[model samples]
Target: MSTSPRSTTWRTRAAVAVATLMAALLTPAAAHAAPEESTPVYSYADAIREAVWVDTGLDDDGDGRPDRVAVDIVRPSEPAQQGQRIPVIMDASPYYSCCGRGNESQLKTYDAAGDVVQMPLFYDNYFVPRGYAFVGVDLAGTNRSDGCVDVGGRSDIQSAKAVIDWLNGRARAYTTRTGTSTVQADWTNGATGMIGKSWDGTIANGVAATGVEGLKTIVPISAISSWYDYYFAQGAPLYDSGPDRLSDAVESSGARAKCAAVQRKLVDGAPRTGDRTPLWTERDYVKDAAKVQASVFLTHGMQDLNVRTKNFGQWWDALAENGVARKIWLSQTGHVDPFDFRRGTWVDTLHRWFDHELLGYDNGIDTEPMADIERHPDQWETSSTWPPSDTRTTTLHPARGDRPGVGTLGLTPGTGTESFTDDPRLSETDWAARIDTSTPAKAGFVTAPLTRDLRLSGSSQVTVTATPTTRTAHLSTVLVDLGPDTVRNYADSAEGISTLTNRTCWGESTAGDSACYLATRAKTTGVTATVFSRGWADLGTYASPDKGVPLTPGTAYTLTVDLAATDHVVPAGHRLALIIAGTDKNLIDPPADTPTLTLDLARTSADLPLVGGAPALTRATTGSAATAPSFTPLDSVSAPGPAPRIPRG
Candidate 1:
């Protein structure tokens, strides 16, 4: 349900004052105002009034410059009581305008008797009274602003900064009009944070990297970290041949349609391919990690089919490398799971970060490390640092003669190989199924049952020694829990609907950080959580089974598949199943003709590192049927080896 906007402004003002005073007296300003409402407050709606763009400027050709940028600002109403300089959050989009390539009718479509047109600022009504002033601007050259859209570049960033400065100036002027003690427009003495999702998230990051003095923090949800990878992965455009790509372009154009003249001229030049371009390389958060310094709370869905999960890890890496110590939350879900207004937990967290950074409130946020990772069934773990120390290492070996139920620890070497065909037609949507029905045609691996509750978190690596006939073979790994004869996935509804979603145990990007599969969500299956899954690459066709014989049939080549880090607490008695099939059931699409491949029947073994000092599970226990056992953060686990190598350029 949409939370009813705060009913009264004075009530909100009073609460803010009381809370601010208490915080001033007892705690550091970094503290967050508790959600527990102390009094009725003003709804943000009551604070800002409807206004229209009465001016115009540049709406034109190929040049990127705002002619007469017009913005709609919403501020607290008149009859001001105590001094209150509001913190503002801004948004700007050009979804409706038609002047140059634009049409008057197209650009000026009004709704409900035309009292108010559905302009760019139409959606920011939710940020009011929550202690923020909202601004929505039509990018210059479009609607009311002046200039062509530059997507993610210097123009967008600088223009946003200019508008922010403009807002701060207007806010100061208003304070003078009211005779308040608010400081003249300067920095975040009054505090400011940027909020938005997707496009907005991207802009917010851009703004942060701009190093705007007044900007305090940012809450970018479901944002793109790298346009290059998002549009094109590994130097290849993902949307080039897919129908969804065309559909997305059409949908994206809807916003630009507001400015017909500008849309007609600029749409053609918009980026389409994934090849490295000046714009994409410059716009990448990973490439420009050092530029961002603001406190950020980044969120992403584990199975977001639209944007690659690599964006999240890349952003996290950027922030970590810059030493920003930002907070990250990776849910086991999709694009907009937590975007609902009524579901204010995300907002609540954002507010806390702002309070800590902008307000200097020490409400325990300082104690919170750079990361607040929530992996599963309602459990949140804190890490003083990311990629927590002491990550457990285990292995799964293929089934061989005389060792039907044993793991990979003590398997003998036998010469053999497993091969499957690659069918490109049938592929799984990242969020649709657990198994890639297509890739399984040639992909294969092994799984096992848990001897005890398993808590796999952070980064996982699979090293395989296999010889491929082809120059490049696509190897994939999947971790699953086999229930009896059926395969049960550890993923959840919140993580996503896909058969397998990428998981990040340590602060790393599975999609781009390494060549492996990462589980999207954390799991803690009960006594039934026995079967655990893992696998290796799907050597593409052109190799022995797919094409030419790259490997000598009897040669011993090892292939490794790395699974993403998981935070699962699988129950005892559940058998971990290692399936070594040439195909995956739900992830990658399988190739049409699978070759008959064989694995060495004799030499297969799992070598799990059993820490000498750390005790292993002596007995098995089951969690209650009512509640699944959650894997708690091991606050003090011994480090398994020297810290894993941090990725480098």
Candidate 2:
């Protein structure tokens, strides 16, 4: 059964009125009346629907005229019925007519009149009634849009920016794909907010980085900050092939033929050599973060191997440094939308966010906590900032243990050395399950069971001084929680949330479209160990992530592997461990040749972000370099090809 909308708490509206009165009391001359939306006060049943092709200055496909971006819109009849213009919410995506969007993979369906009958997700159904216009845009070279796909290049970014430009009356739009006459977005008040998940969200980051006018805010979920990092890490490629695969996937059949040249450019300029090229740099939004003027509400799954947590970590840092007002939600799921795992709260909070940013409502959302981190499955906590600003780095070293292959992690420097031969065949699951066993593939180190619950709040770094027998080698460092626990089954195709038969409606419905969507619950399973964070690098590029310096087979190199940002708690009686290995066959693409690496224990250390810092770690210190029960060999565990839980990168 489809759910129906009920009265919302509208938590921030009362605060908005209070703040407005205070502002008026403080500055009587400067204060003006801002619209206060108390509820879904408008009617979605009579919402106006239309489509337009906005003009982008770029001729990416090499056609004579400028490329046009297709935009499908659904807006409450404020301008038509009430004679009032409203703000806009846009999701410019390549997935609109391709892979689809949201948990149900909802696609746009048009009526015989060529107008959109249903827009994917609940944005339109929910927001339109709240006095906001929603537009679903087809990215350049995809769907009904003009020009060829350039992936995340100038063409792609420009297509979306052009829509914002049109909404703000800075660019042109037409009623049809190749229409000569222009159409104006006169009904919009020009304040625009962009939001999406995955590639769609990635475009939000790119567009916001451009600092384009009229873009008031963005909500990017599981988005990418840099194309280079998406495919490679520290001069090591994450996968084979090039960006053309993604570019071709989204383009329509007719457009694919026209986009052949653009696809070729993507292939030719790909970061296949593991070196950041002009192509990758052009798509690097982090470098331009300082120019961002839009407030951001970002979300990412801690276990998303697809886009990776590093993307949000880096982008968030940049936005913070540049003083871009921002809020974040970090979940334990993998590449899943917050709507799936946190439906009701997601809609409520998001409603407040859009009201504050685009609607210019004086909601106290900005005064609230900046980060909402899900430390465990369905367990959420708020902080003033991510990873807690007071977190301190704790350095731990690896030393020989009582067991043959196992080692201990301690507060003091280690005196001995350890060696591990490269094994690209084994996956992370195998390496983690076999930590205590004697193996040439990896070197494992574990700490004693913690006396108190210790939390790792942010990105950790593993510095390794190793002499490899082979000139070309790959290094991978993984941080693991060594204890039995039940966690969201991110390995599942659903990315931790199982869609339920029951439906929940967010807004009004019509004969053709309803705001009802299948509800979801966290899909969890039991596991003895969990890989929380991991980082990789090519030994040849040990000196720098960008440039490769040739390595001598016999010489040692001090390389640092920066793990993805994470928030995890190792409860009392549980343990934490570090594993250094060669290729992670399941996650990273293996190098042609992997050599045995000999590590100088005294020169290697792992820098952990601990909320409790040094004194907190005192109780958890290894009394002696002895084998821990948690480090026992996992010979019984099996690592099948492509370990589950690696999704939504």
Candidate 3:
């Protein structure tokens, strides 16, 4: 075994080369690493192909730098029978491909955060292993992507198309290895669907508009369709004041970042609109509703205070107008909370929908009944169409003065005026923000309490002429049912049935489109309320006050308070109390310097569409009873943490 020094050196170099070659072969490749490849890396019941980022040279908007696109393919681990490829469910999300913050954090519902958190891709993250490939793609301008953010505009549209094309190719590559045929060249050939919530939900609508070659079906859960209602309700900014923040608050990269990127694009080759024009039409979903062709399964929450419940209504209306076959599921609960992901039923429902449409499977999604939760009944109702055709109106009147213990019935006809001075110095706490305002109520008009259990459920409305001292003032009116004993002292009222206390449940606010008429001749707030059936009852005939002593013709009943609505059942044995005022500092958040309101009751009266036969007023037998609902601080109803996964990417 003896050897020369030169021979020994040669042997050492040969050994070193062998070692380096082995190390290179052992290092994991950057391409999506299979779950079982390294140290038994996390295997989410579903097969997952780790995301990989790629560069696209198109500046998209001449932003100098090339935009980067990234995608992750998740497939079922089990082999398919014969030659069937797994169907593809392509979902686009905004996440950092490198940092993994967007992918690993929350899947985007309303959470207490300072930026937008998208959770759609991760929602049911393991669902892909159930024989479908889930593709999560990043748009051109977001994390690792190199194009200017065009919001829901052209850039986003182009990226969506490109992603779809890429997924088609990826699925072909995937099928070759997995022995599946679920994904075909044509999305509609076998099965391919889109799923998302909120902004991600909106993407389905946008892509459908482009007539994308193969977007079979869409499950748009809790998505926003009307920018007007989502941003400004009837020209008024929505009061998104609750602690459960919105997507924009958390997702926006601060206002400064947005301004910088947008400005840079405008200066560089992008078209510049000096003033308001139709240039932003692409970002407006409502205008493009007619172009959406895919069948959609829409879900929304009536009690969704953040995005305004009207968005769902608007979408439903637009889809119908466009002759699109769409189904909706409205709930009284908050956004995405109803899915109950623990049970895995929600995923099944979505899967069934895609299977029926994309795979041409007889999953019977189309034949399945539509479902919704009626607020008051505290039950789910299934129907073939939305907003059940059986919906009817029951109006409760505001009878005052004639009734004794029912308070100096100021809502009586011929009453002169009821005035209240608002002091912003004291300030009002609306939802959570403390802001200065001249008055506490500003969204809707109100009436005196009805001397009975007034059910104010299912699309309630009120009209009043408001003479604001300033240009505008928010008006909120609450119609309360002052039950038996007209006036009784009670307390401890919680949501749900039979959860009672000393105080009786008496009032409900006009939730969605309540209105107010300004004396200044300006278009007042639109008044239309879609009260969830869970809490308040529909308004019906009420007992008029006894016709005892007559009041002076011109005397005024000055009743004052704010009005709002909720999704909780009010118990029986409760008097109907309607307190109308200029501001609802508790439920609604408005800007400071709120205007002062002056309403003359002499000029206000109800255009009630009465339900039951007009009932007669009975004289109080012996003793008189009346318990007015006094002002009590409101209890907050918002939850915080990671957003539940309902297509919020």
Candidate 2: C-alpha lDDT: 0.81
- Winning candidate number (lDDT): 2
Q: Ten-residue segment with the worst summed lDDT in candidate 2?
A: 1-10
Candidate 1 per-residue lDDT over residues 316-386, each given as its tens digit: 65665566646666654444434321134554565556555544444555445645554443445655645
Using alpha carbons, what is the TM-score of model 3?
0.57
CA error at residue 405 for candidate 1, angstroms: 16
Candidate whose TM-score is highest: 2
* Whole-model lDDT, model 3: 0.39
| Candidate-wise lDDT, in order | 0.41, 0.81, 0.39
TM-score for all predictions? 0.59, 0.92, 0.57
Compare candidates 1 and 2 on lDDT and give the better one.
2
Decreasing lDDT order of the candidates: 2, 1, 3
Who is ahead in TM-score, 1 or 2?
Answer: 2
lDDT of 3 by residue, 403-464 (tens): 31122322235444444434323222231121112234322222323443322323344444
